[model samples]
Target: MISQNTISQVFETARVEEVIGDFVQLKKAGSNFKGLSPFSDERTPSFMVSPVKQIWKDFSTGKGGNAVTFLMEHEHFTYPEAIKYLAKKYNIEVEETQRTDEEKARADERESLYLVSEFANTYFQNVLHKTDQGKAIGLSYFKERGFTEDTIKKFQLGYALDEWQAFTDEALKKGYNIEFLEKTGLTIVKENKRFDRFKGRVMFPIHSMSGRILGFGGRILGNDKKAAKYLNSPESDIYHKSKVLYGLYFAKQTIAKQDNCYLVEGYTDVIQFYQTGIKNVVSSSGTALTPEQIRLINRLTNNITVLFDGDEAGIRASLRGIDLILEQGMNVKVCMFPDGEDPDSFAKSNTLTDLSDYLTEHAKDFIQFKASLLARESKNDPIKKAETIRDIVNSISKIPDQIKREVYIQECSKIMDISEEVLFSTLAQIHKKDYQDANKKYRQEQKAFEVVKNEEYAKPKVDVQYELERKIIEILMLYGDRTEQFEDLVLKEDEVSGDLIMEPTIQKARVFEKIYLDLQEDEMMFSNEKFRELYYSIIDKLNQEEEFSTRDFINQLDQDAASTITGILMEDEKYGIDDWERYQILPKKKTDTLDQLVSQTVLSLRCFLIENKVEELKNNILKDNVDTKTIMEDVKDYNDLKSLLSKKLGKVIGSYVTK
Candidate 1:
């Protein structure tokens, strides 16, 4: 377990914007930072990070929390893992106590897998550097590829011995569990006999964005026609091939800094580019580019330059990735090298300046690259040319931004000697078809959801009191620590008879204290359990701590309560500053109007409770045998009180007459 002091130190040292900015590209927006939602697919940014509060909110998906929660949600890190990550990022020392053997045995499956993967990575690196056979095979192969020792070490490149049981035996001898080793796909077990999966191959460790080893890609040195030349770890709990990008850990910072990512095909391609001073490059790792992978790149920047070999296969791969990038509302460019030269070869042979110049001079926008490539193939054939135009239009239709789509359409029209009008018409038809198909799929999914819901109990409906309770909770979260002078009604016990009586009093206290005491005096409670729990917790913290920290408060709550409070606090920030003015709506700033806002919210809740009582009184009057006169008197008194409260809120009360 991580020491509390270390966790607190991490929380204090880590800035929400800086910690999140490592994984996201953030642009300044007034007092906060805004970026595209890393949790969802979004064109315009809806993710907001407030450095003052040390929290972030994704308005698009409604996920928000402090720095640790953001990591837990975005990167799927356990609480300890998130703390450790922050500690490393901020250079804070993490002091942990050793776990007992029983505790270690009871550790969760995912953490065990992570430990196994880390051990395997270290073991492979040791083998490549320390063992004679590894140096002879793995080290020599990397050296032959012109990879420097520093580059090899930076990427954690390593080699596995030729013997099948070399790695598995060593790992088991180290007392690492067999279950995790097999689960991580580091060891293959057949009929109770286990051997290494990547035997006789050089290892390339694939890392998560946070630099944890998720899996490995191994390249077989000796050619065996029957065996696959390149092998990747099978899918596991922590590693999904489609979602893992080669060299993302190394390239993420550079990618965000440069505002562009260079997409290549293999692990060596990424390494070569990084070694040649082009650090912002990643690979699809020989898999077909996936939407998940595209979204990963989109998080850092919306600009991708796909580096391709001059071979036909490379051209085909570039074409395949272009549409996916465009669909994600990203700008894509293509750079193809000379014939028979891949990124790995090209980067090795050329100087940094030469390679940089070649890329700049040769890189072409996707539309132009596609048009030129297809136009060359369709020379003197009108049918083929018409087909190529349609193909280009199809690519253009996938673009989400209308302005970008129009720009591409015009470019294609000019390049193909076609009219812009004709191209626009084609795009419109394609969009219409796509819209119809999407609607159809949505309806089918909705119907399926309805059927499943019918088989389960329906969720309880929320009452009006729920919103009122939520508003109160929101007030406590936003302004609980501020001192306020409150006129409150308290109950006093008579000394002689011990009877409780109401006493009107005024006190200067924290807003949280005033609200809590006021609620207690009224004998009122929040209708929602979550809101009630959060309210009490906030009050308890305010009473105990000298100064309240919103970030610290959020950390102490469970995920659900933390998320709920975040949604409420960040609700007003959803609207951009210009949006209100543009729409002719002038909302008062909460900081400037806190006193009025708090009083009004409290009055609103009281009025809602009074309205409920008034309705109950009327229901009693409708009963056949009830005391109508007494009920009428009670109703009149409550109505008078409600009217006075409504007047205090700057609103006139409507008549309560019933037909």
Candidate 2:
């Protein structure tokens, strides 16, 4: 466990823009930096980083938080991982509290796998440098591939020795459990024997976006006719190949900055391009491109230019990935090398300037590439050409942006020498079919969801006190520590006569104290359990401390409570871009309206509670023949109290009764 002092130090030292800029490209927007959201696909920037507040908000997805939270969200890192990441970025030493054996044993399975993967990565790298066999084979292979020593180390390239039990033996000797070894797919356990999985292959450690080793991609150097050329770590708790793109950890910042990503097909392809000065590139590691992968790229940039070898297979590969990119609302272009040249070979053969020039000169938009490629096959055959047109239209329909679709339609019509009318008509039919299919899926999902929801828990009916209770909690979070003058109507008992007299009193107190006293005087309690708990917790903390730290308060909460409070605090940022003052529509600041806001909120809550009491009394009056007169009197008294509260709020009694 990291010490609280260390965590606080890390939080204070880490600047939001500096930390996030490592992963995102942020351009100056007024006092804050704005960029495309890392959580969603959008061309116009909706993501803002506030250096002054030390926080960031993505309006597109409604995710906002401090630096640590950003890492947790964008990198899917655990709290500890995010803290460590920030600590490293800011050069702060993390101080740890020693954990007992039992506490260490209680660590989760996923974390164990991560630890094992990290250990294996270090072990492989040690072997590659320390062992003569690794140096001769793995190092030789990487060097022969034209990868510099720095590049090799940067990518953490390694070698697993040919001996079957070499890695398994070392890992077990180091106290790593065999179960975890097998779980991470580093050790293959048979009936009575255990052996290394990537034996004799040059190791390429694949990392998560946060730079944790999730898996490995190993290339076999020795030519064996029957053996596969490359072997990747099998899917495990920590590694999901479909959700990860190779070199993303290294390429994310550049991809965001360049406003484009270069897509390739293999690990070496990515390495070669990166080594040759193309930093904004990633590879599918030979798997067919998935929507998940495209969405990952979409988070960084809206544009992708796929680099393929000048061969039939490479062209087919580019064609396969284009629609997936289009479906995610990204701009895609295709660039093919000279005859028989892949990204790896071409990059090696040409200078950086030459390769860059070639890519710039040859990259074609998806529409043009599709038309030209399909046109060759459908030469002079009207029916084949018509089928090709539909194929193109199908791709166009996958585009999410209507404006982009129309532009592509215009381009496709011009390229294919086909009428825009026919294409639009085909597109309309396709859209109708898609809508029907989507509606059918939605209905099925809705039915399944309804069945589960009904069985587990019924939907909550709205309580009138909900909003007021939430508002109180919000005020306590936002202004609980601030001292303010409060006016109250209190009934005081005369010391000698023992008679109570009502009077107005004024006192200065902390906002939280005033709210607590006001609610206590009326014997009011929160209706929501979560909010109720948070309210008490806030009061307790305020009583103990002179000031409240919103971030600290949020950190002490569980995920649900923390999320709720964060949402409430960040709700105001929704209008951040509106700049109402610029249009002479200046709105009252919360500080200026604090007194009215608090009074109105409290009054509304009292009225709601009284209204509930009156309703209950009216219900009782209608229910029984014996107590109708008594219930009617109780209802009238409650209504009178409600009217008094409304009058105090300066509202006409009968006119505001419906509220």
Candidate 3:
């Protein structure tokens, strides 16, 4: 467990925008920062971070919280892991209790796998630097590859000793469980016998975007004719190779800053570029590109420059992957080295200035490169030439933006010497077929579910009572200590008509006092347990503290309560300033109409609950042996109160009428 004092220091020191800025690219929007939602695939910016509030909200996904919650949501970190991450980022010393053996045994399996993988990373690094055999073999190989000591240590490159049990034995002696070792694929166990998976190989630890060591990719140094040269950790709970981009942990901020990402094919390609001072590059680790990996980059930037080996035979096949990049609506360019050169070797030979210039000069628009390459293949064959044009058109259609698609189509027409009309027709045909297929799928789904599409399967009813209670909580959190003028509705007997009429009486009280007294008078409690807990906690803090800081208050609560309060507090900052300006929408604060806002919320809650009580009475009257007179009288009294409440909230959304 992390000590409360250390957690407080982390919360006090870590800026929400600064911590999140490491992973997300944010631009200033008035007093806040806006960026693309890291939790969802989106083109427009919907994620908002408020520096003043010390909170963030992803409008697209409706996930909002402080810095710690962002880590928990984005990285799937345990609460303690997030606190530790923030502590490290802010350079705060974290005070933690030692985990006992019983606690360790009951810990999460995924966390155990993380522990085992981390231990393996540390062990491998020790072997590479401390052992004579490792220095002579693994260190020499890295040095031969032109990697500096700083770069080697920065990437945490390491080696596993040649002996089969070298790693397994050391790990076992250290109290690392064999089950987790096998699960992380660091060790292979068969019939209780263990062997190091990457024996005799140099290790490159693969990390998640949050810098957790997920697995390893090892390169065998010596000539083994039958063994595969490069081996990766088997797909484990903690690592998915297809979804992991090599060097992203180190490259994320740079990619966002550069407004572009350099795509290479191997780990060395990324390291070589990064070592040479180009920090905005990542590799696919020699696997085929995946949409998940592309979306990861999408969270950072929308432009990619793919660096291909000059002599690669599969360059044409790799073009399919670049098309996936296009499908994500990104601007993609292709660059090639001189024949026989890959990014690693080319960067190694050229000066940094020369390398940067070469990349800038050689990078071609993906369409232009595709057109030139395919046209060369067509030569004098008319049929192949027509097919090349169609292929180019299909790639253009994958772009989600119509303007970009049209622009690329024009470029294709000019490059291929084909008329724009022909290309546009082909693009239209592809879109039409896509629409038809989608429509057919929708029709099939509707037909399959038609029998179940009765009133029972209709849209779920919105819970109005919950909303009313939520509004009360929102008011208490936002303006609890502040005094507001309220209008109390008092039922008075009309002297002439003898009918009860509501008379308004002006009163002044703190927001919390008004809400507490109203709830106490009604003898009501929040039906939602989370809301009930938060309501009392907020009231207690307000009454006791001299100064109530929302950020400090959030820091003291548990995860669920903090997230709920943060969501309510920062909900108004969802739209970027540019959006507000463009839409010409000026927002009115709840404080501006505090009198009506507070009264309306309380009255609405009363009206809703009264209707529910009346409903119960009606249900009781229907039973065979119930006394109808007393129940009818109770229902009549509820209706009278509801009618008075209705007169207050009838004009707004709080109207809760009878069934």
Candidate 4:
């Protein structure tokens, strides 16, 4: 259990924008900031952050929350984990009770696996830096490969001791369960005895997006002819081979800043590039690039430059990954190093500027690269060349961007010497077929889902009435404390000393005060759970500030709250700077656009409530006919509502209009 004092301290000191900015590249959008959605793959930004409100929302996903909620959603963190994450981020001390043995035992399996992986990482680093053999062997090997001491430490490069039980024994003695070790693939267990999985090998820890160690990649250092050159931790709950990209934890911020990613194929390649001053780079670690990995990078930036070895086999194996990237709506370029030159070796020998310039000058779009590679093989053969063009066009059609697809089509036609019309026609046929298949599948899924829902119970209509009322509450929450100067009518109570002093008529004067007091007098509290949470948060902020700006609303609020407030403030309603502008712009005559929207929303909800009350009144009247006074009171209440509506609507919009 976290202490209340610690929670309060975290809430007080933690800034929403600062915490979210570490993961997202937020740019100023009006009073708030907007960026590409981290929850989904998107080419254009749909995620927004508001610092003042201390919330974030992804319009694409419809997920909104405070800072802790954002972390819990984005990183799949437990409540405690999210709090600890924020505490670590803001440099606040987390004061919490120690977990009991039962609590530890009941913890998530994935978290246990992550713990094992972290243990293995720390053990490996200790062996490499502290043990003589590890230093002499593994450290020397990394240094020989041109890895500097800082680079080695930064990447947490380490070597497992040659003895099989060295890591397993230490982990067991430290109270790390041997079962978790085997589950995380950190230890190979046999006959109830565990042995280190990467014995006598150099270790490369694989980390999740939030930088928790998930697994390891090991390279054999000995001259064992039968041994594989490298081995990776078996895919475990915490480490999915397809989704994990090495170095993302270190490179995410740099990638967002650079607005591009340098994609390589190995752990060493990532480290070497980083050592050479190219920071926005990550590795697929020789696994076939997956859409999950591509989306991870897409969350940071839209552009990806795939660096592959110039070997024929290497290029062929990697061609398929480019289409995978394209399917995710990312802009991909290919940079092939010279034969026998991998990114690791290439970066080791060249300066950052030279390598960057070479990559810039030589990188080609996937279509051109594919065409060039295949055209060489299909030279002088019309049928094979046509087949090659179709293949290139197929990849081109996967692009979601129409302009990008068209540009690629033109380039493919020019390269293959085919007419642009022919290539486009081929692309259209392929795209139409794919789209139809996808739509059919989607419709079938929807039908199946509806059948299930209808059989169970039809979903309740989204409480739009409740939501509209909530929006009104949100507006009150945001501006409730603001000093709104209004010309209020007041009557003078006393007359100055004079023989014939006369009482003056009522006078109107501008009075300035907070909205909270007004709402208090009316006896209203924000009635939505999320809105109520935000209301108290705003009150806390208001207490801390002399004057508040909307910028503060976004920047100070949790990322999820900020996102919601941005959507609420910017959506549906039209803005009016001048009173006359409202008349000029609004389509309705009863009131200006903004007021019309507000009134329509409020009245629709109020009518629903009033109708429900009327039904209840009729039920009461039916149950007891002697209660004429009660019936008359209900009738008088309904009349008062109608009169109020008449004043508001300028004329009665309902059937019960009374002049």
Candidate 5:
């Protein structure tokens, strides 16, 4: 619970572009900025940031929101985490309010695990810097690897003592629950005994995209033949290795800044690259690359240069990743080191310029790389060559952009020495089959959705009456800034004259709030719940503003409403611009049209409310003749009311509104 002043400052001072730019490489596109989608693999830019609107939209995924939402989505941050992120980004001091005991009790178990993991990270880092064993072993190992003191601290490399129960003991001493530590895999719990999970290993903390410690990866030192060379934290609430890339927390900025990422297969590979002046590098940590892992990288940059040890298995693994990367709409380029070399050895053996130059000269597109690698074995074997061609075509089809896919297919035809027409035909067949399957599934789902939607209520037609009301509401929301000349009666008492004088002053009242208050007084409920909520929300916004701009209104609205408002404002009308000029767009026809729409919407809502009330009345119907007569009188009066509603609603509700 941050202070109100702090929250305001965070919102005010935190520029959307500035905050988002820290994570995204944004280039100016007109009044906005366009970048590769951070949420999806994209070659061409689909992520648009409107600096003016202070909002971002990812056209690839159809996800858009204000700055807070970008943090929440891209970083997987909770609402509080997003707020805190912004607060930290803007350097606003957070003043948390006291939480009740019940809230503390209800704090989630997953968060507790996160807390424990975080605590463990801090403890390990402290050990590395503070303790003799940590400095001599962990710090010494990192320094020996040519990592600078700053780099060591930046990556938070740490150490765990060889002594059993050292980490567990300290954590428990600090009042951390051992159960959570076990759950988070920070401690190994065997029967009733608990010991430090990464004991005697050089610690490498794994972080979530938002930089929270999710788990650890430790490298065993000395003659620990009984221990695995590298042990990673087991699956926990916060740690998902398949999705988490090592060094991403540090490399995200550099990757985004350079608009490209260097992918490696080990932690040391990442360290070596960073040490050798390539800051935008991350590792798969010796695991087979996952779609989730690729997606994680996809969120930061579109161009990926996969650096692999020049081994057959490494090349095969890298080939496997290329298709996944292509499927994500990312541009994939392969850069293999010399035979028997890895990123670690290669970077260390050469200067940064030499290493970078080698990568630039050697990098090849996936299709070309795969063809060259496979052709030697497949040559003169038509079946093998055909299979190879199909594999290349399959990879080409995985590309999201049709043009890019076609281009790849053409390139494959040239490389494989196959006909372009044949490859294009094959692609068409695959695409057609895929589309049909997808279309059939989508239609089946659509049919099922329709059945469910129709089960509770009959099919709805255009609700003419409600449409009128909605139209009026939209008018109020859109043109609410129209200042009408109104005379204000001011009573002023003058001491010198000893007389009170009545003076008339012209004042402008905002129509939006006026309509809003008027509707509130009448208890107006629109037929559509969403529209009703939106109506009230728009009114609330207007009330908060001194002068309302439709653009401002749209800016504050949710995406759907904003789009709807844009549609309404942008829609071209066939009827009258000359008429609009004379009427100030509020002539009888337009006003009557809007007024009619609004009246109809209100009437429909009123009818629904009245029917509900009637149901309640009927539920209580019973007893004496006097009571019966009163009920009958009320019913008769309601029938007359219905007739009046029908008459009033019938004119404008002719047929456009939808329920």
Candidate 6:
């Protein structure tokens, strides 16, 4: 457990932009930084970071919070992991509080797997450098591939010794659990027998975007007919190969800088290109490209230049992957190396300048590349040529942007020497087919929707009570400790006339106090559980602290509450700004209307509650036999109170009152 002082220090020192910028590529948007959401695949920027408030909100997904919560959401870090990461980032000396046994036992399984992988990463690196067999075999293989000692260390390349139980035995000796090792695919354990899975292989550690080791891809050094050439860690809780891009941790910053990524097919290709100073390169780890992996790169850039090997057959088979990239709305370009050269071989043989020059000269847009490759193969065959044109048309249709699809259709028309009318007709046909197919999927899901649609209790309705409670909470969070003047609506008797009247009295109180007094006088409790809990929490904090900080308060909250608070603040900020101000059409400021805002909001809530009470009292006659006379009088009294409240509420709503 981290000490309170340390947590406070971390929250105070660590900058949100500085922390989140490590993962997201943020650009200045007026006072805030805006970027494409890492949480969703939106072309426009919806992720906003307010450095002033020390919080961020992804409008695309509605996930908002302080920096700590950002880490928890984006990196899947445990609360402690996020804190420790920040403490490390800001160079804070974390002070520990001793944990009880039960607390220690509560640490989750995924984090344990992460620790095990981290340990394996360190252990393998040690073997590659420190041990005789590792140095001779693993180091030798990497060197032969033209990788330097610095390159080897940069990629965290390592070697696994040939002995069957070498890794498993050493891991167990160090008290690392065999269960984790087996799960991470570092060891094979069955029938009480254990052996190293990557034995006699050179290791390439696959990392998450944040530089944590998720798993390893090991290449067998020996050409044994019985053994596979490359072995990847099996799917586990931490590592999913289809979603994990090799070398993304190192490539992301450069990709963001260059505004393009060079895609390859293996670990060595990424490392080799990176070693050659082409740093914005990543591999799919030989897995077919997935939408998840494409979105990962999409965070940094919308452009991808896929580097293909010189094999025509492989290129033809991989054409579908190009459509996947296009479907993501990514600008796709293809660069094919010369015969007999892969990215690894090409980079190894050429100087940085030569390799860079070759890439610039050879890269072609996917439409042109696909058309040229497919068309050249069917140049003399009219039937195959027509089929090639349709194949290229299909690729163009995968592009999500309608405008881009049109432009590409024009390009495809010129390339295939076909009519624009024909191409547009074909596009319409493709879209129609796509819609039908999607509608079929929708029909299949209609049964699921049918089962779901009837549960009115499951569906949240328009809730005025909950909204009012939430508004009170939002107002408190935003202006809790600020002092303000309020017109307290006082009920009094007109003794001379023998009638009742309402009087307004001036009083000074903090914003939170004004809200608290109103609710307490009404004997009201928030109907929403979350808002009710938060209402008390906010009041207690405001009462105790002389100086209030929203960021600090949020940092101390549980994730759900923190997210809710941040969401409210962000949503308010979004609407609070009047965009027409850009046209010199200034709107009223929130602070200028604070008094009226508070009075009207509270009055509105009271009126709503009174109306409900009146309804309930009126409905009592519909119930079992009761005293009709007493119920009628009670209803009349409530109605009189409701009427008085409505008058005051109407005055507040109609115009601001200076009391």
- Candidate No. with top TM-score: 3
* Every candidate's lDDT: 0.86, 0.83, 0.87, 0.75, 0.75, 0.87
**Model 2 over residues 23-77: C-alpha lDDT tens digits?**
6677765457777787876666777776755567788887877777888788777
lDDT of 3 by residue, 1-659 (tens): 78889987988899999889988888888789998888887878888898998988888887888999999888889889999999998789999888888976778998899999999999999999999989999999999999999999999999999999999999999999898999998889889788989989999999999899999999999899887889999999999999899999999999998899999999999999999989999999999999989988987888999998865567887999999999888899999888888999999988899999999999999999999989988999999999999998999989999999999999999999989998999999999998999999999988876554567558778899888777887888778888887766678999999998777688888888888988787698888888898899889988998667888888777777877877776666775635676576776655667767777788778878888888899999989998899999988988977786687676333322221
Residue 43 error, candidate 6, Å: 4.9
Per-residue lDDT of 384 in model 2:
98
lDDT of 5 at 140: 91
Per-residue error at 166 for model 3, in Å?
1.0
Residue-by-residue lDDT tens digits, candidate 5, 1-659: 55667656666677778877866677765456767677775566667776655666776676766676677677666656777988887778887888788977776787788789888888899999999999999889888887888878888888999998899999999989888988998888888888877879898889876788898899988896889999999987678889889998789888987888989988888988898899999998888889888877776677999887778765775687888888888999888888888899899888999998998999898888888878866999999998888878887888989899888888888888889999999888888988999999999888776545464367557666456556655666656656443333346787789786555465555556445553574475666776677777777776777776654455456546654554344222212212344455543344434444444555665565556656665655664344666676677766655565555456436533431
Task: Give candidates' CA RMSD values in order.
Answer: 5.6, 5.0, 3.4, 6.9, 9.6, 3.2
What TM-score does candidate 4 get on C-alpha atoms?
0.81
Candidate 2 backbone overlaps, count: 0
lDDT of 3: 0.87
The backbone clash count of each candidate, in order, is 0, 0, 0, 25, 9, 0
lDDT of 4 at 154: 92
Worst 10 residues of 6 by lDDT: 572-581
TM-score for each predicted model, relative to the true structure: 0.89, 0.86, 0.92, 0.81, 0.73, 0.91
Tens digits of per-residue lDDT for model 6, 1-659: 88989888988899998888877877775467777788987877778888878888888899999999999999999988888999987899999999999997898889979988988889899999999999999999899999999999999999899999988888899988888888888889889898889889999999998888899998997879899899999999999888899989999889988999999998999999999999999999988889999989988888999999989988987788899999988999999999999999999999999999999999998989999999899998999998898888888888889999999889988888889999899888888999999999999988675554467777769889878888888888888899888776677988898677788888888999888888786798788888888889999999999878888788888999999888887774453223344577555667887877888888889889878887888888788888888888988987887888788887776667553
Task: Extract clashing residue pairs from model 5.
Answer: 38-299, 462-657, 463-657, 463-658, 465-653, 468-597, 468-598, 469-597, 469-598
Q: Decide which is better by TM-score, 3 or 4.
A: 3
Model 4 per-residue lDDT tens digits across residues 1-659:
78777776776777767667767777765456777788886777777766656666677787766677777787788877877877887788989888788987788977777777877888899999999999999999999999999998999999999897988899989999878888888888889776777878999988877778878899999999887789999987778888889999999999988899999988999999999999999999888888888888887788999998878887888889999899888888998898889899999999999988989998988777899999998999999998899889988888888998999888887888889999889988998999899999999888876544363356557776558656654554445444422322223335554343223232222111233343344244545777767656666666766665554465456555665666565442212112234355543432223223333444545555555566777777767446868776986797666445434444223311331
| TM accuracy, model 3 | 0.92
Of the two candidates 1 and 3, the one with more favorable lDDT, higher being better, is: 3
